[model samples]
Target: MSVLDCGCGPGTITQGIAQIVAPGKVIGCDLEPGMVERAAALAEGANLDNLSFQVGNILDLPFEDNTFDAVLSCAVTEHLGEPVKAMSELGRVVKRGGVVGITRTDWAAHMIAPSCGAVNRFFELFESGFNLQGGTMNGGRNLPSMLGEAGLNVVDVLIALSGAYTPEPGNAMVNGWAEWIENLPLFDRVIEEGLTTRDELDAMCAEMREWGAQPGTIAATGGCRVVARKD
Candidate 1:
């Protein structure tokens, strides 16, 4: 079956999808030009003939209606400036029986205690941007409602829970919080906005690392997998 990867980044996932769907077509699209280029390189490196990467905004997908059999997005929906518009576009492009999936970090669930004062401020500001962009920290929280409103049926709702380990002085929960903040694209932005400082970020991460030394610190990704069928 054909597949579309919305908000695909660096084609790491695109290349994986290409491998999974050998002899079938797989297209990856992203809003960032840098990401599109990176995806193209990865796809080409893998020699994935069925894979293609494009740069396009989700709010206004540059594809015709009923053009895909399935669409998947990861760590992206929450970053969209217009998730509703983006969701509407996702629903509009796929044919009946086609499936759609979205995965994003659950910001609401992210906790960072014992952090540097600056990093704490940054975390708060960064989380706020999820709303500023018209999305949310927990993209899956309202998946059913959002998809239903967009004229799609909730075919399935799968929840995936995962844990990471730092194996040191830090505990899983503590390291998890540190990792989340360090991994955010908004961290720098927030810092620039005077929400926090680099020293704070480093201190927090160091503390987490120290705290995670035993058997490794761990972070659990309590994510939701939503399957929606086009009407």
Candidate 2:
């Protein structure tokens, strides 16, 4: 069946979806033209003839109504200022009886064993900055109801926990996350707003690194996955 991968950043998951629906059309849409270009290039490099990429915003998708057989979006709604509007747009594009799947990370459910105060401070500041930037840090849990509100029937809900167990120093799981934390725009916005200083941020990152270095250090986060159907 045809599918649309909304906010298909970098085409990582979109490529997988294309493979799943081989010979069926799959369109990956993202807001950034660069991302679209990157996705398209990756798809071409992988010889995924069934996949295509386009520039589009979730709030206002470029497709006509009932265009695709199904729609799938991952890790997108949490970043939107108008998440329900975006969901409605997804519903608008899918044909009748089509499925819409969304997966979102729930920051409120994020857990760290032997938690460090510095890490806590970091998340607090980060989440505050995220909200200030018109994003929700822990909106994953509400997506099922949001889908229903957007005129879709909720079919299933799955809560999955992703974790790093005793990760080595500079491993991808913990280190990659730390790196992403270091580069997030939220921290920059937080600094610009005078909410915190860069020095403190550096200290926090250092402490978090030390915490991750400790033996048996574990970090876990939850992802809420929802499946809805268009009536």
Candidate 3:
């Protein structure tokens, strides 16, 4: 069956979907032209004839009504102000009885053990800045309701906790997260909004590294996947 991967970043998951639905068409769409180019290049490199990529928006998808047999999106709704409207658009592109799956992060359920002051301060600033930018921090937990509101029949909801523990010697988990989070656009947003200074942000990341170095450090976050049918 045909499939659409909305907001497919880099097409890593989209490539896998194309493989799963070989001989059937799969279109990966994203808002960024650069991301579309990269996804298309990846598909070309893999020599997958059934896969294609395009630039599109979640709130205003470019496809015609009932264009796809199924749709899958991940980590995109949380950044959207009108998540229900976006889901409605996803539904609009699916054939009757087609499925739509979405995965999102519930930031309220995120937990970092050995919760140091720096980490806490960082989250405070980051969350505030994120909300100020019109993004939802707890979008995952609301997906089921959002889907239902979008005129889809909720089929399943899977909520899970994913995390990594910091191992000794290299301080893998903590160091990696510290570096990764520092590089995220959210970090820059926090600074740009004057919520925190660059020095403080750097210090926070450093402290996170140190905190992870301590014994029994674990960083976990909650995520949810909701599946619905366009009946």
TM-score of each: 0.81, 0.95, 0.91
* lDDT tens digits by residue: candidate 2, 172-199: 3555556756898778888999989989
Q: What lDDT does model 3 reach?
A: 0.85
lDDT of 3 at 19: 93
Cα deviation at 154, candidate 3, in Å, is 0.4
Top candidate by lDDT = 2
For each candidate, the alpha-carbon lDDT, in order, equals: 0.73, 0.86, 0.85
Tens-place lDDT digits, model 1, residues 115-167: 34533444466676566556666666776677788788888887666555444
- Between candidates 1 and 3, the one scoring higher on lDDT is 3
Candidate 1, superposed: residue stretches over 4 Å from native:
110-125, 132-134, 166-185, 192-194
The stretch of ten residues in a row with the least summed lDDT in candidate 3 is: 165-174
Model 3 TM-score? 0.91
Of 1 and 2, the candidate ranking higher by TM-score: 2
Determine the C-alpha RMSD for candidate 2 after optimal superposition of all C-alphas. Answer: 1.5
Q: What is the descending TM-score order? A: 2, 3, 1
Candidate 2 TM-score over all chains jointly = 0.95
